[model samples]
Target: MTTDPQTLTWFKSSYSGNGGSCVEWAPMQATVTGIVPVRDSKAPNGPVLSVPSRSFAEFIAGVKGGAFSAT
Candidate 1:
């Protein structure tokens, strides 16, 4: 299913604070289509990355586990 990016409500993590290097996601759209629409917070009009719900969940889990940590 296709959705207009402009129509979706995008939000960034509270931890983002005032930093411009953050990512935004459309939770409502994800709930409706099972696809997580992600985009750079600095570029609201830029391209969006559509990730599968399962893949997104795994990515989040890995993040929580520090699998992608820089340290």
Candidate 2:
């Protein structure tokens, strides 16, 4: 499904804690389409990164599991 990114509502995680470096995602769009739209919260009109739902879920899991740790 195709959608205008501008029309979709975007939101950041509460864990973001007011940091300007947070990333935002459109959950409604993700629900409608299998694609997850991600973008920098600092730039609302900036380019969006479209990730497959399964891949996105895996990435989130990895984050929760600390797979992407800087250490």
Candidate 3:
């Protein structure tokens, strides 16, 4: 499914730290496609990662659970 980048309502995850390093995603779009499109907010026109919705959920759960230690 082709999606117009401009139409995507990209939003950063609440888990994102205040630091500059962060990723943004479009939740509404993900629900429809079963794929979550994510990109670096600092580079709006940059490449995007389209992951399976289930995988995205696992990733978020890991983040919230602090499975990955802060560097």
Best by TM-score: 1
- Report the lDDT of model 2 for residue 9: 93
What candidate 1 gets wrong by more than 4 Å, as runs, is none
Error of 2 at 3 (Å): 1.6
In model 2, the worst 10-residue window by lDDT is 1-10
C-alpha lDDT of residue 38 in model 1: 98
lDDT tens readout by residue for model 3, 1-71: 37976689999867678896889999888989898989998889988888899999998799789999989
List all candidate RMSDs to the true structure. Answer: 1.2, 1.5, 1.7
Q: Give the poorly placed runs of model 3, Cα more than 4 Å off.
A: 15-18
Ranked by TM-score, the better of candidates 1 and 2 is 1
lDDT (Cα, tens digit) per residue for candidate 1, span 14-69:
88888688999999998988999999988888899999999999998998898995
CA lDDT of 55 in candidate 2? Answer: 94
**Comparing 2 and 3 by lDDT, which wins?**
2
Q: Write the per-residue lDDT of candidate 2 for residues 12-52, one digit (tens) a residue.
A: 98889875879999988888888999999888888999999
Residue pairs in clash, model 1? none
User: In model 2, where do residues sit more than 4 Å from their true spots?
Assistant: none
Q: What is the C-alpha lDDT of each candidate?
A: 0.91, 0.88, 0.87
Q: Give the local distance difference test score of model 2.
A: 0.88
